[model samples]
Target chain A: MNQNYSTVAQRSSSVLATNKVLRNTYLLLSLTLLFSGLTAGLSMFLNMPPMTYLISVISGMVIAMFVLPRFANSTAGIGIVFLITGLLGFGLGPMLTMYASLPNGGNIITLSLGGTGVIFMGLSAYALATRKDFSFLGGFLMVGFLLVLIAALANIFLQIPAMSLAISSVVILIMSGFILYDTSRIIHGGETNYVLATIGLYMTIFNIFISLLQILGIMGNDD
Target chain B: MDWMQIASALALGMFLIILFPAALQMMKNSPKAAPSDWKAVIVPMIIIVLFIMLLIKLV
Candidate 1:
């Protein structure tokens, strides 16, 4: 399959790269996921309002953009990652609560979670094994990413269900592209810091789950 | 428009504005993909689409 990756001399730098960062990224990612889930459960138990979701997510985004990068190389970065994840997960509680009120909501949530797991694992494995550079995805994903952001922002006021469904479907594909790009970056040394890398991968998984949940939930409602 | 909706639209707009330049720079600096490279990504993406469709049907 990946001939260059198979042989010793021709092996892509990815296979030869220090896999310690990769291993650590996964470890930290799992820990953050558990922390986030715990916080989400706590938020739901407290009956957090929908606004809390909006507020916390906005706060988390601000922190991620302005603060996390400065400290991403330090141990403090780990704390920041947990803080951001917990905040976002806390935000997620109300959304999940809303979904849970629907018929067959549990199935929708479970399947979205499971589907996220399968897609992340499958894409990550492929990226790792193939040893192909996905750097070219940079420009394409950027255009797609920006266009989708504009569409999503417009849809907020439009409140069109079909448009929302289309957005969610496109989001699934975009996040998948990100997974490949991010994973390949890690392998090829384009991404070295485990903290930053974990955050990238974590966000992709989170988005995939959210988009999947929305898509499946909408489909169920149509039944 | 409601205050909340206006606030949301502003927030999303600001997020895009903040991120755009850096995203564009990164895109410009990265290497271009070969025609052959597209082959690898398209195959899995198709499989993913089909798998998602199946999940929708099964559910």
Candidate 2:
């Protein structure tokens, strides 16, 4: 009886821990999204030059990869999350403006935003409800990500619109896989830190949104 | 070339440098997958593709 009781207690505690992480991650993600949106709006209002985006985004990635992880365990991580996300959003400002300039730009943006929301919600719900281990995707997705990055970098010189569309489509698939992997990790206790979890999800959503925009823009021929 | 093109190439190149080695290491360490795993990934992807196609058609 004691052995059985101990097992039950351990499982219960694991479940509780998972719940806490999942709850905190979603809460932080929502707040950060709102924060980023505001910064993007400010950037758009200022009409920052196009180059502002590339520089800010590169800086954000560098910080997120190198600096944020160090502070991820402390309260300072929250502030850093905001800083990184704000920089990314601000970078998006000029891109959004360019899209909005297209004849059907407004519609394209709205549709992309909606599509991203739907995909994220759908995938998250599936992973949470099923509680499957998607850790297996890590290798495959990482390899695909590298391959796509190589393609994208090469295409910078090529500058082919069709290739851009292909890259965007592949990116969407990769991001979708990440959503499932990240959500599953939260449920299975693979990820314990809500801060890191929040960053992972936020970046996935950010990638999905941007990829959708590129895909939609190309499909709409807003060149 | 325009400044924007130069900036993009530089940024993308840096991103590749930062992400490449890490990704390769992760891939090296990741576990081998079962068929069910691939199915899990593929089904959802197909749905996503169809959903995207629908969205494109709507556009």
Kindly report which residue pairs in candidate 2 clash with one another: none
lDDT of 2 by residue, B1-59 (tens): 78777777887788778887888887887778889878877998999999999878766
Model 1: per-residue lDDT, tens digit, A23-65?
9889999999999899888888998988887788789889989
Which 10 successive residues of model 1 chain A have the least lDDT summed?
A: A9-18
Give candidate 1's total backbone clashes. Answer: 0
DockQ of each: 0.67, 0.74
Stretches of model 1 off by over 4 angstroms after superposition: A1-17
Query: What is the fnat score of candidate 1?
Result: 0.56
Error of 2 at A136 (Å): 0.8
For each candidate in turn, the TM-score is 0.93, 0.96
